[model samples]
Target: MEFHEPVMVREVLSVLRPGPLSRVVDGTLGTAGHALEFARLIGSQGILVGLDRDPAMLAIGARRLNEAKGKDGPRLHLVARPYEEICEVLQDAGMTEGVDAILLDLGVNSLQLENPERGFAFSKEGPLDGRFNTEAQATTMADLVNNASERELADWLRDYADERLARPIARRIAARRALAPLRTTTELAELVREAYPPAQRFGRIHPATRTFQALRIAVNDEMGSVERGLKACMSALAPGGVLASISFHSIEDRITKRIFQGATDAKPDPSNPYSATTTEGLEFELPFRRPIACTAEEAESNPRARSAKLRAIRRMEVTS
Candidate 1:
């Protein structure tokens, strides 16, 4: 299976600037595309920790990294765990000093999206199973679609995907599932398509796109994971260390931006507005004022890069 081509590698490398002996973490190591370059930059004496929830991805990433690392390369540590558990992973690896750099390339990778059996693509025919870690997750897309109430379905569709036709779609799903459970991607897609008004049915994008995205997000609790993972990474950064995140959609981007902004921006105490004391300490600084977007050339070459946004922050050096 073809893993995702790491998006905006040049931009990520430029911001991260990992050096020889620097400890780094690729929190979303999808087949080691970015981790391979990091291993090269950090050199033989460096420590590289790669984390992924999917056991399949961890296995593939380990194999690829092993092939590239050879006899002289970074000490590799591949963990089958979510990025939210970064601190615990580091502690387990005996790196309480923290990591020099961390990277989180959020959202679904091409490995899961392109594979029909993964049930991430609305256009494909597959089982309604969208769990990233099938062995761990008890609930699946099938379970959500077949068991969730109309209100629950509508709420998830609206909140997760920003689907405007959430109510109509939920109504349709409720009506259909009353007769038989929705069991396939195509079945759910068609139901969502039918929910749209005839004129809006065949727009530039498929009617089911938002619905599918919402379902996948709900099935995997993707937003919650991203939020927790971002916080964990920021806390796990060593002094003068850098953290970079690549988000595929607006919601994910917003969560990253919020966490990074909170760390970098200081707020005044509400009780005493004139006081110099601030509620938050300036522990981190934004490397760039604005998030970086993929270049035109990159967007043209890789369609997935169109919506990709890269943001970076650096932990400030502490002085006595």
Candidate 2:
């Protein structure tokens, strides 16, 4: 299977320049597409830590790195854990001081979406299991769809996917599951299509697109992970280190923007609520005022690149 080329490789490399002997982390390793590039840049003297919740992906990543790096390359520490637990990963790797650079490629990758068995795509026929870490005993998409109350379903649909027909969709799902459980991607997708107004059923995207996206997000707790993972990455950066994040949707971008802004923005004085002061210790600075977008050429070649947004920040040296 061909994993999609890592999005905005040029932009990501530009923002995160991992030099020889540098320590770097690819928080969302995927198939090691970005991690391979990082390995090449950091060289054999560097240390590369790759984290992924999926053992399958981590196995693939390790193989790819091993095959590509040969006998002489960065020391590899591929961990089967979530990026939100970076502090522990770093400490275990003996880098408690921090890494020189970190990369967080957020949202589902082509590997997961392409595999029908993983059930990440609305276009495919597969079980309603969308957990990123399939090995974990966490709630699956089927669990939520089959068991969640109508109100709960609607809330998740609206909050996670911005689905305009969330209530109707939830009602339809609740009604259908009462008779027989919605067990497959196509089953749920068709139901969502039926829930939409005839006119809206076929628009710029499939009627089931939002519902599937919302379900995957809810099943994986993606937004919460992104929030925690970004914060962990920021905290794990050594002085003068950089953290770059690539978000596929508005909500992920918003969370990244908020976290990065909070770190860089001036703080309100604790002693005087009315006064704002520059934070007195180590701080962060935005390398770019605006998020970076893929080139039109790249977007044409890789459709997924169209929605990709890259944001980066650097930790400043200690300042009293």
Model 1: which residue pairs collide?
Answer: none
Q: After best superposition, candidate 1 residue 318: deviation in angstroms?
A: 1.6
lDDT for predicted candidate 2 compared with the true structure: 0.87
Off by over 4 Å in 1: 199-204, 268-282
**What local lDDT does model 2 show for residue 220?**
83
- Cα-based lDDT for every prediction: 0.88, 0.87
Off by over 4 Å in 2: 199-204, 269-281
Q: How many backbone clashes does candidate 1 have?
A: 0
TM-score result, candidate 2: 0.93
Tens digit of per-residue lDDT, candidate 2, span 1-320 = 57757999988898999889999999989899899999998888999999998888888889999999976689999998999999999999889899899999988888888888998887889999988888784788999999989999999889888888899999999999999998999999999999977898888898988888998988888888987788788889899899999999898998787777767767653544222222235588999979999999999999989999999989997765
How well does each candidate superpose onto the true structure, as a TM-score?
Answer: 0.93, 0.93
Q: Kindly list the per-residue Cα lDDT of model 1 for residues 54-170, writing each as its tens digit.
A: 888889889999999987789999999999999999999999998899999988888888888989888789999988899999999999999999999999999988899899899
Model 1 lDDT, residue 47, Cα: 94
